[model samples]
Target: MKLAVLATGNIANKVTQTLVQIKELECYAVASRELSKAQQFKERFGFKKAYGSYEEMVCDPEVELVYITSPHSHHFEHMKLCIEHGKNVICEKAFTVNAAQAREIKSLAQEHKVFVTEAIWTRYMPSRSIINKVLSDGLIGDVKAITANLCYNVCHRNRVSNPTLAGGALLDVGVYCINFALMHLGSDIREIHSTWQKIDTGVDGMNTISIQYNDGRLANLTSAITAKSDRQGIVYGTKGYMVITNINNPSLIRVFDYDDKLIKSVEVPPQISGYEYEFIESVKAIGEGRIESWSMPLTDSIEVMTIMDQIRAQWGLRYPME
Candidate 1:
């Protein structure tokens, strides 16, 4: 599969390194607004070609898949470009600025018969199923609550502080906490409440969200771009609790009883930066002529975005793009 990356940013660099490690996918092309930056990325990642603009890259006949690593606010526009060109897309998380844009792109992809999916990565990781199995096997007994926190000191970055770019902790990292809760606790949310602190840019800098599911389960989630956190996710149950060391890229899962006694620890399978799974899955879906990955379906993406929209609405926060 020939993969074209849409940006020359840090994430594009990281994901490209992992793409080269996969035998089936080729880092065929890269694109940036400036030709020189694209050329630099091409040389650094050994891409077969580099284009000065995304328009040029997507027009390539050999580019079957376009991985969009652009900013959150630009995802809708970039994805539309790819789908319009009849190219499959693997868009980064926070799929769009809002649920409206998400629905539009989803409809466009289906109309074009192009395989478009969100690159939420965690949904495709091996740890997802491993944790599911542990829960289903009665090891954790009856699941009740979930707690996840993901934070980093990223306020210094322009993309993290600019509302025009959909800058915020919720869309950037808080989405992971929401994804974590939905993945394990299910999304039949009964009630939602949150408190958020905004930065000078008018985007959320820190947020604490609480969700109540129809099953009476509760989730306490927090995300911040102004500070650092332990980045842990815990699934609490009647009998025991499971701890996921890093909700973003789970490397280890630990289980403990109500007495706080250690029960078991499981290490995730070795990975090539933990991004190969999503790309591999996207390639497989495209090969099978599927418009979405079974793991991270378009509906799931829409649901997650809708949840974020509701959260933002509650906080009276709206991005400039929206």
Candidate 2:
């Protein structure tokens, strides 16, 4: 699989480092608004080519897959550009600024017969399926509720404070907590109640969201950009509960019995920054002539974005681009 990256940002750098570790994948090209940055990124990552303009990079016939690591506000535009050029895409999370944009991109990808997927890395991790199997096997008995927290002191970052960039703790980190709950608890969100504290820029700085599923399961999730959190996710059940150390990239999973005794512990396999799984899945999907990854389908992406739209509406938050 020949892969090209659309941005030379921090996330793209980390992803490039992981891409080099995969023997089957090649870092073919990288692009940025500035040629110097793209050249630096290319030299550092050993990419075959670099482009100052994204349009030029997407037009390369050899670049089969393009990873859009740009800001959330630019995802829809960048993704549509790649799809229009007959290139598959793996876009970073907060798939777009809103659910409406996500639907448009999905429709475009289907019409062009191009593979496009959200790079919500957790959905493609092997630990996710293992945890699902544990729950299905009744190790934790009947599930009742789930609680997840993902917070970081990243308010100083421009992307987290600028409304034009669709900056917010909800779209950046809260998406992980929501994905954690939805991946394990199911996505039949019946009721949603949320409250948030907004920064002066009108983006959410801290938020508390409660989601009730159709099956009576509830998820309590919290995210913040002003403070640090444990980033833990717990699934409570009739018998006991399971603890996931990190919701973003789960490294350890511990299961406890009714007496709170540790009954099982699973260590995730060694990873190359945990980003390779999603890239590998995308390659496989495209190889099979699929327009979307089964692990993180377009429907799931739209569902998550819809939930975020509802939360933002309740908080009276709207980005400038919207």
Candidate 3:
């Protein structure tokens, strides 16, 4: 697979590096809004070409997959262009600013018969699935509650705090919280009640979301870009509970029982900087002519966006396009 990376930012660099780790894949090119930035990425990564615009990157005939790494606002346009040009894509998370835009782009990909997926690396990891299996086997007994908190002092003015860039702790950090909860608790969210405190940029700096699952389980979730936290998340039940330290990139699942006895402390798979599993799954699926990933299906991605949309609406936060 000849891949054209859509940005030169931190995540873009990670995606490119991850792709390079695969012997079957090649980073054909890298692109950034700034020509110098693109050249720098190409030089560092040894990519074949660099482009100042995403249009040029997508138009490269040698580029089979366009890994979009731009900000939220640019994802829709860039991915749409790639799909239109018959290139499959793996877009950054929070798939789009809204579910409406995400659906449109996905439909376009379907029409073009090109696979498009959200780069939710967590869903594709074997460690994640193993933990899921443990939970599914009732190793934790009847599920009770989920507690997810992700907080790191994003002290700087990041897009997560800027409305123009679809920034917020919810979209930036809390989506993973939501996804984590939904994963163990299932997608049928019974009720959602949330509160937010805005940063200087009019987007949420920190927020707490209370979700009630249809199965009578509760998810108490919180995210913050202005504060520091342990970043641990919990999933509980009548029988036992699973404690995942650092919900976003979990590397441990500690199970405890009703009597507070340690059921097991499972050592997760060794971690990698860029998360190679998701990219590997993308290559395998797309190479097999599959349109959606079985691990994180298109419907689930759409549902995640829908949940975010409603939460943002509740917070009275609107993006540039909205």
Candidate 4:
């Protein structure tokens, strides 16, 4: 798989580094609006090619996959360019600014017979897989409830408080909370109630989402840029509970039986920030002629976006040109 990453920023760097780690995939090139940035990245990552424009990179037949690592507001445009050019895409989340944009991209990708997914690396990580196995084994019995807290002291990232950029904790940091709940509990987000701490840009500096399911299962999920919470999550059930420490990054998962007895802690590590898994998955799915990923389908991405959109609407958070 030959992959070209759009935007030579932080995430683009991560994507390229991870792509190189895959045995079959090559980080063919990197492109950014700034030509110097792309050139610098090529030297730093050893990618053979670099482009100042995404369109120019996508036109190359050698590029089998295109990773859109642009800003949240620019995902739709970047994805459209890649899909229209007949390139598969691994997009960064909030997939798009809203669910409506996600729908548009999905339709285009399907019509083109191309694969597309929110390059939400965490969902495709080994830690998530390990936990899935534990849950399927009934180690936690029937999942009764879930609590996730993801708050960090991102004082340097004013994007959370920048209205012009749609920088909020919900889209940037909180997306993981929503994805974790949806993965463990399934795609049924019946109702969501969210409250936020106001940022300088009138967006949420910190927000907590309460998701209720049909089976009386509820998840208390929270995301913030104000201060660090436990940065951990718990899935509880009648039989046992699973504890996920350092939920935001790659880490270990510990399962406990009743009376808070430790069942086991799976030590799955040596993963590079866990972002590499999603890119590799996209390559496999596309190679198999699949239009969507079974692990995290386009519909699943839209469902998560729908929940995020509703949460934003309830909090009076609106992004520009959305």
Candidate 5:
């Protein structure tokens, strides 16, 4: 599969580093607003071609898949651009600013009959299935609640503090916590209670959310851009509990009994950069003539975006683009 990246940002750099290690994918093209940046990325990663503009790269008929590494604010525009050009897209997390934009992108992708999926890497990791198997096998009998926290001291970065860029802790880090809960608990949410503290830029600097499920289960989640957190996801159950090392990219899963006796510890499988799974899945899906990935389907993407939209509504937070 020929792969093209649409940005020369930090994420693009990291993912490209892993792409060169994947034999199934070609580091075909990279585009940036500035040609020099794209050229540098091309030289650094050995990409076949570099484009000065996104439009120019997407215009290339040989580009099979375009990985979008733009900010949360530009996801809709970038995805739409790819889909309109009859190209398959794998966009970075937060899919869109809101559910409305997500739905619109979905409609456009369907109209174009192209493959499109969100690049939420956790959903596609092998550890996801391992965690699910543990829960399914009654290792955590009758799951009752979940607690996940993912935080980073990144407010100094413009993209993490700028409202116009749809920058905030929620979209950048909170989305992972939300996905962690939904991935394990299932999305039968009954009520959502949330609170947030804003930074000087009027974006959410820190936020806490409590989700009530229809089955009487609860998810207590927290995310912040101003401070650092342990980045753990704990699932409590009647028989025992499991502690996930890192919710962002789960490194290990440890199961225990009610007596706090450690039952088992499972380490995540080895990988290039823990990001190769999304690209691998996208390639498989496109080869199978599928429009969405089974790992992170469009419906799951929209549900997550909707939940964030509700949370923002509670705090009366709206991005400039929204």
Candidate 6:
């Protein structure tokens, strides 16, 4: 599979490092608005070709897959461009600023017969099934509530504070918490209550979200760009509770008995930066002529975006693009 990355940012760098290790994917091309940066990225990551602009890269007939790592605000635009070119796309989390954009992309993808899915890597990782198995096997019987938090001290970065970029904790770290809840708790949400603290740029610096499921289950989530957190996802069940270390990238899942004694622990399988799974899945889906990845289906992506949209609506946090 030939792969092209659509950005030359920090995430692009990290993902490219992992891309080099995937034998199934060719480091085909990389694109940036600036030709020099693209050239640098191409040489650094050993991409076969470099494009001065995204349009140029997507225009390449050999580019089988495009991994979009742009900012949240630009995702809809970039995805539209790629879909129009009939390119399979795996976009970063917070698939778009809102569900409307996500829906439009979904429609365009179907119309173009192109594969499109969110690169919320957690969904594709082995740990997700590990956690699911624990719950399914009744190790944590009758799941009742979940508490997940993902926070980082990144407010100083322009991408975290710029309203024009759709910058905020909710779209970034908070999306993980939301996905963490939905992946485990299911998305039959009865009600959603959320509050946020805004940064100087009028974007959410931190936010807390509570979701009530129709099954009488609850999910409490928190995300912030101004602080660091333990990043744990805890599931409370009738028989026992499970502790997931790092909801962002779960490393270990510990199951505890009613007495708070650790009964079992499962460590996630090793990986090459935890991103290869999404790419591998994307490639497989595209090869199978599928329009979505099973790990993070298009409908799931839209639902996650819808939930985020509702939360932002609650906070009255409208971005410039919106």
Q: For residues 164-276, could you state the per-residue lDDT of candidate 3 as single tens digits?
A: 77888888888888888878778888899999988878888899999987878898999989998788888778787788877777778888887879978887777565367
The local distance difference test score of each candidate is 0.94, 0.93, 0.83, 0.84, 0.94, 0.93
Candidate 1 lDDT by residue in tens digits, 1-322: 9999999898898888899899879889999999999999999989999999999998899999999999999999999999999999999998999999999999999899999999999999999989988998888899999999999999989987789999899999999999999999888999999999989889999999999999899999999999999999999999999999999999999999989998989999989899999999999989999999989999899999999999999999998666
- Stretch of 10 with least lDDT, candidate 3: 267-276
Task: Show where candidate 5 strays beyond 4 Å.
Answer: none
Tell how far residue 44 is off in model 4, in angstroms: 1.2
How do the candidates rank by lDDT, highest first? 5, 1, 2, 6, 4, 3
Find the 10 residues in a row with the least total lDDT in model 1.
313-322
True-structure lDDT of candidate 4: 0.84
Predicted candidate 4 versus true structure: per-residue lDDT over 23-44, tens digit per residue: 7688788888988899999889
Q: Which stretches of candidate 4 lie over 4 Å from their true place?
A: none
Per-residue alpha-carbon lDDT of candidate 2 for residues 1-322, written as tens digits (9 for 90 to 100): 9999998998988788889998868999999999999999999988999999998999899999999999999999999999999999999998999999999999999999999999999999989877987798898899999999999999989987788989899999999999998897778889999999988778889999999999999999999999999999999999999999999999999999999999999999988889999999999999999999989999999999999999999988988888
What TM-score should be assigned to candidate 2?
Answer: 0.99
Please write out the lDDT profile of model 5 over residues 1-322, one tens digit for every residue.
9999999999999888888988879999999999999999999999999999999999999999999999999999999999999999999988999999999988998999999999999999999889989999998799999999999999999987899999899999999999999998889999999999899999999999999999999999999999999999999999999999988888999999999999989999888889999999999999999999999889999999999999999999999887
lDDT of 3 at 160: 63
TM-score of 3: 0.96
223, model 3: CA deviation in Å? 0.6
lDDT for model 2? 0.93
Determine which window of 10 residues in candidate 2 has minimal summed lDDT: 128-137
Go through the candidates in order and give the C-alpha RMSD of each one to the true structure.
0.8, 0.8, 1.4, 1.5, 0.7, 0.7
